[model samples]
Target: MDTITVKRRVMMPIRAGDVMAEFISFQGDRSGKEHIGISFEGKTPSFASHVPLVRLHSECLTGDVFGSGRCDCGEQLDEAIDLINQEGGYILYLRQEGRGIGLYAKLEAYALQDKGFDTYQANDMLNLPEDGRDFRIAAQMLKALGVSKIRLLTNNPDKARQLIMYGIDITEQVPTKVHVNQYNHHYLKTKADRKCHTMTFDD
Candidate 1:
Protein backbone atom coordinates (compact mmCIF):
# COMPACT_ATOMS: atom_id res chain seq x y z
CA MET A 1 0.00 0.00 0.00
CA ASP A 2 1.27 3.45 -0.91
CA THR A 3 1.56 6.17 1.69
CA ILE A 4 -1.11 8.88 1.61
CA THR A 5 -0.47 12.22 3.32
CA VAL A 6 -2.67 14.99 4.64
CA LYS A 7 -2.86 17.74 1.99
CA ARG A 8 -4.67 20.34 4.02
CA ARG A 9 -6.38 20.91 7.34
CA VAL A 10 -8.96 23.58 8.04
CA MET A 11 -11.42 24.32 10.80
CA MET A 12 -14.82 23.85 9.19
CA PRO A 13 -18.09 24.40 11.03
CA ILE A 14 -20.55 21.94 9.55
CA ARG A 15 -24.31 22.18 9.44
CA ALA A 16 -24.48 20.18 12.63
CA GLY A 17 -24.54 23.62 14.31
CA ASP A 18 -21.71 24.83 16.55
CA VAL A 19 -19.84 21.53 16.10
CA MET A 20 -16.34 22.47 14.94
CA ALA A 21 -14.17 19.88 13.29
CA GLU A 22 -10.76 19.89 11.68
CA PHE A 23 -11.41 18.98 8.07
CA ILE A 24 -8.49 17.17 6.43
CA SER A 25 -7.78 16.53 2.77
CA PHE A 26 -5.45 13.80 1.58
CA GLN A 27 -2.74 13.72 -1.05
CA GLY A 28 -1.87 10.64 -3.18
CA ASP A 29 -5.06 8.72 -2.36
CA ARG A 30 -4.81 5.57 -4.47
CA SER A 31 -8.50 5.73 -5.33
CA GLY A 32 -8.01 9.24 -6.81
CA LYS A 33 -11.24 10.37 -5.17
CA GLU A 34 -11.59 13.49 -3.05
CA HIS A 35 -12.09 11.68 0.23
CA ILE A 36 -12.02 13.70 3.46
CA GLY A 37 -11.58 13.25 7.18
CA ILE A 38 -13.39 15.29 9.84
CA SER A 39 -11.62 15.20 13.17
CA PHE A 40 -13.23 16.06 16.50
CA GLU A 41 -11.09 16.04 19.59
CA GLY A 42 -12.56 14.07 22.48
CA LYS A 43 -14.12 16.36 25.05
CA THR A 44 -14.58 13.99 27.95
CA PRO A 45 -11.64 12.48 29.76
CA SER A 46 -13.05 8.96 29.52
CA PHE A 47 -13.58 9.27 25.75
CA ALA A 48 -10.20 10.93 25.24
CA SER A 49 -8.47 8.16 27.11
CA HIS A 50 -9.74 5.48 24.72
CA VAL A 51 -8.66 4.94 21.13
CA PRO A 52 -10.23 7.39 18.68
CA LEU A 53 -13.66 6.56 17.30
CA VAL A 54 -13.80 6.29 13.50
CA ARG A 55 -16.58 6.25 10.91
CA LEU A 56 -16.11 5.42 7.21
CA HIS A 57 -19.19 6.95 5.59
CA SER A 58 -19.82 6.49 1.88
CA GLU A 59 -21.31 9.33 -0.13
CA CYS A 60 -25.10 9.43 -0.47
CA LEU A 61 -26.44 12.34 -2.48
CA THR A 62 -30.14 11.64 -2.06
CA GLY A 63 -29.92 10.91 1.62
CA ASP A 64 -27.15 13.15 2.90
CA VAL A 65 -27.92 16.34 1.02
CA PHE A 66 -31.66 16.26 0.30
CA GLY A 67 -32.66 14.37 3.44
CA SER A 68 -34.28 11.62 1.42
CA GLY A 69 -35.90 8.98 3.59
CA ARG A 70 -35.22 6.09 1.25
CA CYS A 71 -32.09 5.18 3.25
CA ASP A 72 -30.37 5.91 6.56
CA CYS A 73 -27.30 7.55 4.97
CA GLY A 74 -28.20 11.14 5.83
CA GLU A 75 -29.25 10.35 9.35
CA GLN A 76 -26.17 8.24 9.90
CA LEU A 77 -23.88 11.02 8.68
CA ASP A 78 -25.54 13.49 11.01
CA GLU A 79 -25.40 11.05 13.87
CA ALA A 80 -21.71 10.32 13.23
CA ILE A 81 -20.81 13.99 13.53
CA ASP A 82 -22.45 14.32 16.93
CA LEU A 83 -21.23 11.01 18.29
CA ILE A 84 -17.65 11.42 17.03
CA ASN A 85 -17.63 14.99 18.30
CA GLN A 86 -18.56 13.88 21.80
CA GLU A 87 -16.09 10.96 21.72
CA GLY A 88 -12.93 12.19 19.90
CA GLY A 89 -12.82 10.54 16.51
CA TYR A 90 -12.60 10.95 12.77
CA ILE A 91 -15.28 10.58 10.10
CA LEU A 92 -13.79 9.55 6.76
CA TYR A 93 -16.31 10.81 4.21
CA LEU A 94 -15.65 8.57 1.27
CA ARG A 95 -16.72 9.38 -2.28
CA GLN A 96 -17.77 5.88 -3.15
CA GLU A 97 -21.31 6.90 -3.98
CA GLY A 98 -24.00 4.19 -4.22
CA ARG A 99 -21.73 1.46 -2.96
CA GLY A 100 -19.04 2.44 -5.47
CA ILE A 101 -21.28 1.95 -8.52
CA GLY A 102 -21.39 5.71 -9.19
CA LEU A 103 -24.46 7.98 -9.10
CA TYR A 104 -26.12 6.97 -12.37
CA ALA A 105 -25.86 3.26 -11.72
CA LYS A 106 -27.26 3.80 -8.23
CA LEU A 107 -30.28 5.62 -9.63
CA GLU A 108 -30.82 2.79 -12.08
CA ALA A 109 -30.67 0.35 -9.22
CA TYR A 110 -33.15 2.48 -7.35
CA ALA A 111 -35.56 2.04 -10.27
CA LEU A 112 -35.21 -1.70 -9.88
CA GLN A 113 -35.76 -1.27 -6.16
CA ASP A 114 -39.00 0.60 -6.89
CA LYS A 115 -40.04 -2.36 -9.00
CA GLY A 116 -39.95 -4.62 -5.91
CA PHE A 117 -36.36 -5.84 -5.97
CA ASP A 118 -34.24 -5.79 -2.83
CA THR A 119 -31.18 -3.53 -2.67
CA TYR A 120 -28.64 -6.25 -3.38
CA GLN A 121 -30.96 -7.81 -5.95
CA ALA A 122 -31.10 -4.54 -7.79
CA ASN A 123 -27.31 -4.36 -7.83
CA ASP A 124 -27.19 -7.93 -9.14
CA MET A 125 -29.60 -7.04 -11.92
CA LEU A 126 -27.26 -4.25 -12.88
CA ASN A 127 -24.24 -6.54 -12.77
CA LEU A 128 -22.61 -4.69 -9.90
CA PRO A 129 -21.05 -6.01 -6.75
CA GLU A 130 -23.34 -6.20 -3.71
CA ASP A 131 -20.87 -3.86 -2.04
CA GLY A 132 -18.10 -2.22 -4.06
CA ARG A 133 -16.66 -0.08 -1.29
CA ASP A 134 -12.95 -0.58 -0.48
CA PHE A 135 -11.83 0.17 3.07
CA ARG A 136 -8.09 0.07 2.29
CA ILE A 137 -8.19 3.76 1.59
CA ALA A 138 -9.75 4.28 5.00
CA ALA A 139 -6.89 2.42 6.58
CA GLN A 140 -4.46 4.61 4.65
CA MET A 141 -6.26 7.72 5.85
CA LEU A 142 -5.87 6.57 9.43
CA LYS A 143 -2.20 5.89 8.86
CA ALA A 144 -1.73 9.40 7.49
CA LEU A 145 -3.38 10.77 10.62
CA GLY A 146 -0.85 8.82 12.72
CA VAL A 147 -3.45 6.45 14.07
CA SER A 148 -3.16 2.70 13.76
CA LYS A 149 -5.84 1.81 16.30
CA ILE A 150 -9.44 2.88 16.65
CA ARG A 151 -12.82 2.09 18.13
CA LEU A 152 -14.81 1.95 14.90
CA LEU A 153 -18.27 3.50 14.91
CA THR A 154 -20.29 1.40 12.52
CA ASN A 155 -22.67 -1.58 12.28
CA ASN A 156 -21.17 -3.03 9.12
CA PRO A 157 -18.82 -5.89 9.90
CA ASP A 158 -17.19 -5.56 6.48
CA LYS A 159 -15.80 -2.16 7.48
CA ALA A 160 -14.14 -3.66 10.53
CA ARG A 161 -12.99 -6.75 8.66
CA GLN A 162 -11.48 -4.76 5.83
CA LEU A 163 -9.80 -2.28 8.12
CA ILE A 164 -8.27 -5.13 10.06
CA MET A 165 -7.11 -6.74 6.83
CA TYR A 166 -5.49 -3.45 5.82
CA GLY A 167 -3.51 -3.29 9.11
CA ILE A 168 -5.73 -1.00 11.19
CA ASP A 169 -6.08 -2.09 14.76
CA ILE A 170 -9.76 -2.17 15.60
CA THR A 171 -9.82 -2.09 19.35
CA GLU A 172 -13.64 -2.10 19.37
CA GLN A 173 -16.66 -1.93 17.07
CA VAL A 174 -19.44 0.50 17.97
CA PRO A 175 -22.84 0.03 16.35
CA THR A 176 -24.82 2.92 14.99
CA LYS A 177 -28.52 3.21 15.83
CA VAL A 178 -31.08 1.96 13.32
CA HIS A 179 -32.78 4.92 11.69
CA VAL A 180 -35.70 3.09 10.12
CA ASN A 181 -38.83 4.73 8.76
CA GLN A 182 -41.62 3.74 6.39
CA TYR A 183 -39.68 4.80 3.32
CA ASN A 184 -36.54 3.01 4.39
CA HIS A 185 -37.84 0.12 6.47
CA HIS A 186 -37.44 -2.53 3.78
CA TYR A 187 -34.09 -1.16 2.70
CA LEU A 188 -32.81 -1.28 6.26
CA LYS A 189 -34.23 -4.76 6.77
CA THR A 190 -32.44 -6.04 3.69
CA LYS A 191 -29.16 -4.67 5.06
CA ALA A 192 -29.71 -6.42 8.39
CA ASP A 193 -30.67 -9.74 6.83
CA ARG A 194 -28.49 -9.78 3.71
CA LYS A 195 -25.50 -7.59 4.53
CA CYS A 196 -25.35 -8.68 8.19
CA HIS A 197 -25.56 -5.15 9.52
CA THR A 198 -26.06 -5.01 13.28
CA MET A 199 -29.59 -3.69 13.46
CA THR A 200 -32.79 -4.42 15.37
CA PHE A 201 -36.21 -3.34 14.21
CA ASP A 202 -38.88 -2.28 16.65
CA ASP A 203 -41.48 -3.86 14.41
Candidate 2:
Protein backbone atom coordinates (compact mmCIF):
# COMPACT_ATOMS: atom_id res chain seq x y z
CA MET A 1 0.00 0.00 0.00
CA ASP A 2 1.19 3.48 -0.85
CA THR A 3 1.53 6.12 1.83
CA ILE A 4 -0.99 8.97 1.76
CA THR A 5 0.37 12.38 2.62
CA VAL A 6 -2.29 14.47 4.26
CA LYS A 7 -1.49 17.93 2.94
CA ARG A 8 -3.70 19.57 5.52
CA ARG A 9 -6.67 19.03 7.86
CA VAL A 10 -9.57 21.41 8.04
CA MET A 11 -12.39 21.47 10.57
CA MET A 12 -15.82 21.97 9.09
CA PRO A 13 -19.42 21.55 10.02
CA ILE A 14 -22.37 20.05 8.16
CA ARG A 15 -25.90 20.64 9.31
CA ALA A 16 -28.28 17.82 8.44
CA GLY A 17 -31.76 18.16 9.92
CA ASP A 18 -31.38 18.92 13.63
CA VAL A 19 -27.97 17.33 13.84
CA MET A 20 -24.84 19.33 13.21
CA ALA A 21 -21.72 17.24 12.55
CA GLU A 22 -18.14 18.34 12.96
CA PHE A 23 -15.91 16.93 10.23
CA ILE A 24 -12.23 16.91 9.37
CA SER A 25 -10.78 17.19 5.89
CA PHE A 26 -7.63 15.58 4.58
CA GLN A 27 -6.25 16.54 1.23
CA GLY A 28 -6.20 13.30 -0.71
CA ASP A 29 -3.98 11.97 -3.49
CA ARG A 30 -5.86 13.97 -6.04
CA SER A 31 -5.30 17.70 -6.22
CA GLY A 32 -8.21 19.97 -5.37
CA LYS A 33 -10.08 17.06 -3.77
CA GLU A 34 -10.16 16.54 0.00
CA HIS A 35 -11.56 13.52 1.78
CA ILE A 36 -14.07 14.53 4.46
CA GLY A 37 -14.39 12.41 7.62
CA ILE A 38 -17.41 13.05 9.82
CA SER A 39 -16.60 12.60 13.49
CA PHE A 40 -18.72 10.33 15.67
CA GLU A 41 -16.62 11.71 18.58
CA GLY A 42 -17.84 9.90 21.68
CA LYS A 43 -19.30 6.67 20.30
CA THR A 44 -16.61 5.99 17.68
CA PRO A 45 -13.73 5.35 20.08
CA SER A 46 -15.57 2.42 21.61
CA PHE A 47 -15.58 0.57 18.27
CA ALA A 48 -12.00 1.46 17.34
CA SER A 49 -10.68 -1.88 18.60
CA HIS A 50 -13.35 -3.73 16.67
CA VAL A 51 -14.03 -2.91 13.04
CA PRO A 52 -15.10 0.68 12.56
CA LEU A 53 -18.54 0.95 11.00
CA VAL A 54 -17.44 2.55 7.76
CA ARG A 55 -19.45 3.65 4.75
CA LEU A 56 -17.89 4.32 1.32
CA HIS A 57 -20.71 6.24 -0.27
CA SER A 58 -20.12 7.38 -3.82
CA GLU A 59 -21.17 10.89 -4.75
CA CYS A 60 -24.82 11.14 -5.69
CA LEU A 61 -25.50 14.76 -6.49
CA THR A 62 -29.16 14.29 -7.32
CA GLY A 63 -30.04 11.75 -4.70
CA ASP A 64 -27.59 12.74 -2.01
CA VAL A 65 -27.44 16.47 -2.35
CA PHE A 66 -30.66 17.41 -4.12
CA GLY A 67 -32.93 14.86 -2.42
CA SER A 68 -34.00 13.29 -5.70
CA GLY A 69 -36.36 10.36 -5.29
CA ARG A 70 -34.96 8.46 -8.28
CA CYS A 71 -32.78 6.64 -5.74
CA ASP A 72 -32.49 6.25 -1.96
CA CYS A 73 -28.90 7.46 -1.79
CA GLY A 74 -29.86 10.52 0.22
CA GLU A 75 -31.98 8.59 2.66
CA GLN A 76 -29.31 5.96 3.12
CA LEU A 77 -26.72 8.67 3.74
CA ASP A 78 -28.90 10.27 6.38
CA GLU A 79 -29.45 6.91 7.99
CA ALA A 80 -25.74 6.19 8.00
CA ILE A 81 -25.02 9.53 9.66
CA ASP A 82 -27.62 8.93 12.34
CA LEU A 83 -26.43 5.42 13.04
CA ILE A 84 -22.81 6.50 13.14
CA ASN A 85 -23.70 9.24 15.59
CA GLN A 86 -25.19 6.72 17.99
CA GLU A 87 -22.96 3.70 17.29
CA GLY A 88 -19.82 5.57 16.14
CA GLY A 89 -18.18 5.26 12.68
CA TYR A 90 -17.16 7.12 9.55
CA ILE A 91 -18.52 7.90 6.09
CA LEU A 92 -16.04 8.08 3.18
CA TYR A 93 -17.69 10.38 0.68
CA LEU A 94 -16.04 9.41 -2.58
CA ARG A 95 -16.38 11.73 -5.55
CA GLN A 96 -17.17 8.98 -8.00
CA GLU A 97 -20.32 10.58 -9.27
CA GLY A 98 -22.66 8.24 -11.17
CA ARG A 99 -20.59 5.20 -10.21
CA GLY A 100 -17.45 6.84 -11.61
CA ILE A 101 -19.03 7.79 -14.94
CA GLY A 102 -19.24 11.47 -13.87
CA LEU A 103 -22.31 13.72 -13.64
CA TYR A 104 -23.26 13.92 -17.32
CA ALA A 105 -23.19 10.17 -17.80
CA LYS A 106 -25.20 9.71 -14.62
CA LEU A 107 -27.76 12.12 -15.96
CA GLU A 108 -27.83 10.10 -19.16
CA ALA A 109 -28.27 6.97 -17.12
CA TYR A 110 -31.17 8.64 -15.35
CA ALA A 111 -32.76 9.34 -18.73
CA LEU A 112 -32.25 5.75 -19.78
CA GLN A 113 -33.71 4.53 -16.49
CA ASP A 114 -36.72 6.72 -17.16
CA LYS A 115 -36.96 5.07 -20.56
CA GLY A 116 -37.16 1.67 -18.80
CA PHE A 117 -33.49 0.69 -18.74
CA ASP A 118 -32.14 -0.49 -15.42
CA THR A 119 -29.12 1.25 -13.87
CA TYR A 120 -26.60 -1.32 -15.04
CA GLN A 121 -28.00 -1.56 -18.56
CA ALA A 122 -28.09 2.20 -18.91
CA ASN A 123 -24.42 2.51 -17.89
CA ASP A 124 -23.57 -0.38 -20.23
CA MET A 125 -25.35 1.46 -23.04
CA LEU A 126 -23.24 4.52 -22.28
CA ASN A 127 -20.06 2.42 -22.62
CA LEU A 128 -19.39 2.71 -18.92
CA PRO A 129 -18.76 -0.05 -16.47
CA GLU A 130 -21.56 -0.90 -14.06
CA ASP A 131 -19.42 0.56 -11.23
CA GLY A 132 -16.08 2.18 -11.88
CA ARG A 133 -15.07 3.22 -8.34
CA ASP A 134 -11.65 2.21 -7.04
CA PHE A 135 -11.33 1.67 -3.29
CA ARG A 136 -7.54 1.76 -3.18
CA ILE A 137 -7.52 5.41 -2.21
CA ALA A 138 -10.12 4.69 0.43
CA ALA A 139 -7.84 2.04 1.89
CA GLN A 140 -5.02 4.52 1.99
CA MET A 141 -7.21 7.07 3.72
CA LEU A 142 -8.31 4.50 6.28
CA LYS A 143 -4.70 3.65 7.00
CA ALA A 144 -3.95 7.31 7.45
CA LEU A 145 -6.79 7.55 9.94
CA GLY A 146 -5.37 4.53 11.85
CA VAL A 147 -8.23 2.25 10.89
CA SER A 148 -7.00 -1.29 10.44
CA LYS A 149 -10.40 -3.01 10.16
CA ILE A 150 -13.97 -2.09 9.47
CA ARG A 151 -17.51 -3.39 9.86
CA LEU A 152 -18.71 -1.76 6.70
CA LEU A 153 -22.21 -0.30 6.39
CA THR A 154 -23.40 -0.89 2.89
CA ASN A 155 -25.51 -3.12 0.63
CA ASN A 156 -22.81 -3.27 -2.06
CA PRO A 157 -20.77 -6.48 -1.81
CA ASP A 158 -18.24 -5.30 -4.35
CA LYS A 159 -17.31 -2.50 -1.98
CA ALA A 160 -16.46 -5.04 0.70
CA ARG A 161 -14.43 -7.14 -1.72
CA GLN A 162 -12.62 -4.14 -3.08
CA LEU A 163 -11.71 -2.84 0.36
CA ILE A 164 -10.37 -6.24 1.40
CA MET A 165 -8.48 -6.55 -1.88
CA TYR A 166 -6.78 -3.27 -1.03
CA GLY A 167 -5.68 -4.75 2.35
CA ILE A 168 -8.28 -3.25 4.71
CA ASP A 169 -9.54 -5.89 7.12
CA ILE A 170 -13.32 -6.26 6.89
CA THR A 171 -14.57 -7.72 10.17
CA GLU A 172 -18.26 -7.74 9.17
CA GLN A 173 -20.79 -6.58 6.62
CA VAL A 174 -23.68 -4.32 7.67
CA PRO A 175 -26.55 -3.76 5.29
CA THR A 176 -28.21 -0.39 4.64
CA LYS A 177 -31.70 -0.44 3.18
CA VAL A 178 -34.42 2.14 2.57
CA HIS A 179 -38.04 1.68 1.59
CA VAL A 180 -38.44 1.71 -2.19
CA ASN A 181 -40.54 4.35 -3.85
CA GLN A 182 -42.31 4.24 -7.22
CA TYR A 183 -39.43 6.12 -8.81
CA ASN A 184 -36.59 3.95 -7.46
CA HIS A 185 -38.08 0.46 -7.26
CA HIS A 186 -36.58 -1.00 -10.43
CA TYR A 187 -33.41 0.96 -9.97
CA LEU A 188 -32.95 -0.66 -6.57
CA LYS A 189 -33.74 -4.08 -8.01
CA THR A 190 -31.06 -3.72 -10.66
CA LYS A 191 -28.59 -2.88 -7.91
CA ALA A 192 -29.62 -5.98 -5.96
CA ASP A 193 -29.78 -8.38 -8.90
CA ARG A 194 -27.06 -7.12 -11.22
CA LYS A 195 -24.64 -5.44 -8.84
CA CYS A 196 -24.95 -8.12 -6.18
CA HIS A 197 -25.99 -5.60 -3.54
CA THR A 198 -27.35 -7.21 -0.35
CA MET A 199 -30.62 -5.24 -0.35
CA THR A 200 -33.79 -7.33 -0.16
CA PHE A 201 -37.06 -6.14 -1.62
CA ASP A 202 -39.00 -7.97 1.07
CA ASP A 203 -37.97 -5.17 3.39
Steric overlap count per candidate: 0, 0
Each candidate's TM vs. the true structure? 0.96, 0.88
As for candidate 1, its clashing pairs are none
* lDDT, candidates in the order shown: 0.92, 0.77
- lDDT by residue for model 1 over 1-203, one digit each (tens)? 67899999999877755888999999996667999999998677594447998999999999999999999999999999888888898999999999999999999999999999999999999999999998899999999999999999999999999999999998889999999888999999999999899999887
Number of the predicted model whose TM-score against the real structure is largest: 1
Models, CA RMSD each:
1.3, 2.5
**Over 4 Å off in model 2, which ranges?**
10-13, 16-20, 44-50
Alpha-carbon deviation at 198 in model 1, angstroms: 0.5
